[model samples]
Target: MSSDALAELSAQLPGDALLVGADAVEAYRRDRALDPTAGVPLAVALPRTTAEVQAVVRWAAAHGIPIVPRGAGTGLSGGASAVDGGIVLSTERMRDLRIDRTTRTATVQPGLLNAELKAAAAAEGLWYPPDPASYEICSIGGNIATNAGGLCCVKYGVTVDYVLGLEVVLADGRALRLGGPLIKDVAGLSLTKLFVGSEGTLGVITEITLRLLPAAPAPRIVAAWFASIEAAAAAIAEISTTIRPSLLEYMDRTCIDAVEDLLGRGLDRDAAALVLGGSDDLDPDGRDVAFMIDAFRRHGACEVAETGRAEGEALAAARRAAIPAVERRGRLLLSDVGVPLPRLGDLIAGVDAISRDREVTIAMLAHAGDGNTHPLVVFDPTDAVAAERAELAYGEIMSLAISLGGTISGEHGVGRMKRPWLREQIGDDALEIAERIKLALDPDGILNPGAIFEAR
Candidate 1:
């Protein structure tokens, strides 16, 4: 992009909304992935309203400059990484929200943080269930862009489930409304769902309409430590088949050790794995918790603890802290893969085997009930050999997931990091269709270039 084009674009936007200097644009170049190859953008546009977003989109479309939409910069994949000579369109300033009790819906701008939305909903006796590990730091827009999933997703759902509508700015700068507050609307095509997880490939999401529910009943938790990794995987499989736990999570030896090292929480450092379960139902029948405990015992749990409210929360907090704690160990390549519920054991075991064979410190954790796992590969950037091994191990894990009839990406979108493997999972016909759609919507190839599909 030329300097004159940058100046013209900056002038079109509101005061101070455009940051073009090198130092000011540094933070906008990468998300949590910290992609070493991330490029310095031509500018960083922080738009506070849909109009400002339209202005930026117009400028980009006219100049044919790529625009990457950013939320709270908490994405694990390089979905928000800047393209060379492009602009990073950030939604951090677009923080506006309105909650409707009668409709049980919240109309919010893209910039709101997930935890902020949750707190706002909670104050109105409602709940927004999608809670990623980085819930407090991740933006609602990024969550929607990635179709993020979290612990409660086993019983509740992911970001796409709650998104009823969106206001997206197209490549040509036209603002389009996809859906609305109505719960069931088959007015046209399922365009709303299509946009939910597009990962900013097609357009810029400026506003969102979220569906809500009555606050969930406080959950009772069950914690189990296993003598062997197989035993923990077995417990998870058994429970998934027998009961629908509100939250079913697993952390292997590496994860437990990482968290323990950081928190000094007295986690079983020698245990092969740890499984956490939760039940949110106000059941007079009392089936969920009992079923989980029984499954744990049947699958060879070394020890089990069913706890009160406070103790249960402490355990959940530890699970949420796993990603950040493990990050302290080294740089990471995070994989979010999912297999069939029945094959959960095989998936976990396969990942363990990959770690050993590759000689990489692969810390594994999961939302077990949904068969979704996040295998974090830790490597020292200074050690070239170890980093190469970690990269190989990362691809191997995805290949393993595919062999077992699992997806390469479960909730996290196939951002730039995972783009190469996407065709391996989806095959040529599907990829072709996806590419055609991308061309149709973003003809200029300006929105999040090199994200899902590469620039032609």
Candidate 2:
């Protein structure tokens, strides 16, 4: 049956579109989260156009086979983990884009990388502000799938905010267009946003129309190093509540040391935590920078510095590289838990307690202004007991976030890794309504069967 289905799909797609065999399908199995339970797919379908995507969906629907929609496979939440006997639908080949200056929007195919989109917009003297840490490699389609937030999200907003429209291929091969460049369309049920963070459960995004802004001045940065984690956290809480920073981020001692070891950039390894704050406001008085410095001093920051353009950019880049640098220490169980700005300090303290209790190395970092943190739980894969403890700590961190009136996932979507805790975060009534919507759209549960919602 698998062989026959592969043949049918091959016949319908372009000659090089359908790939079978273990060697060809291996790379499509797992995303960045590297879910160990990810299954070997029956085939991978690389579609270059919307019609081809629709055709692949139709074929999978007819066979009642699951379809895992993947875009660049850079997702950190295992949202694109392949399923057994399913078809991996990759949109990496569908790279098309057009920037309309008049409309202040860019219409693009789902496969286009976020960096590529930004460059295109920059060439036209426009800017697309939603930039994830992996913006250089992560696809725009995946950003929409997770409603991804980033460094600039502290002020500029996330992926969903910039999305003006989308062309999605539904489970039954029907193409649906929602919203457009006009910006003020309230004629419908706001269905476009419904699919933004759906994690591919409802449909496959074929194309997107993103809102753009006129390019703004680069931000000036303030860097602070503290002798205590609580001090740094207190400063972040103060800055977040008091001012709107273009960027605000935090890194614990483990993260700072890891990054310093990797880059040799003279970072203070003895510091308990490092905080970076930025302001792009046109004010010449540099009020935000002064305010941040004062807050840091008041919170007992050991050392503080206001940097110029080159130095500031370098600092921001180091913050972005925190994840990969820390990963060099050991295998990681990444967590994306977030809370209200006022509770940021408590969340940090709770995570620290969990790490100590579990005896696991959790290198913490965050978009501090928005209270979204990425705690990299490091464990030696060779040590079974250590791995188990790390897993426990991972879930505990999410639970801690929930206890603080936060979410299990801030931007990475509820993917398989976080699915177990989704119910606890959202409650039964909300989950049921979400499940009903999933069934109403993809009755067979073919589109990303085990991503946001479980396969029935």
lDDT of 2 at 83: 94
Candidate 1 residue-wise lDDT, 187-300, digit = tens? 889999889889999889999999999999999899999989889988888888877889999998889999998888888998989999999988977689988988899888
For candidate 2, give the lDDT of residue 373: 95
**Per-model TM-score versus the true fold:** 0.99, 0.99
Per-residue lDDT of candidate 2, residues 184-257 (tens digit): 88896989999999999999999999999999899989999999999999999899999999999999999999
lDDT of each: 0.91, 0.93
Give candidate 1 regions above 4 Å deviation: none
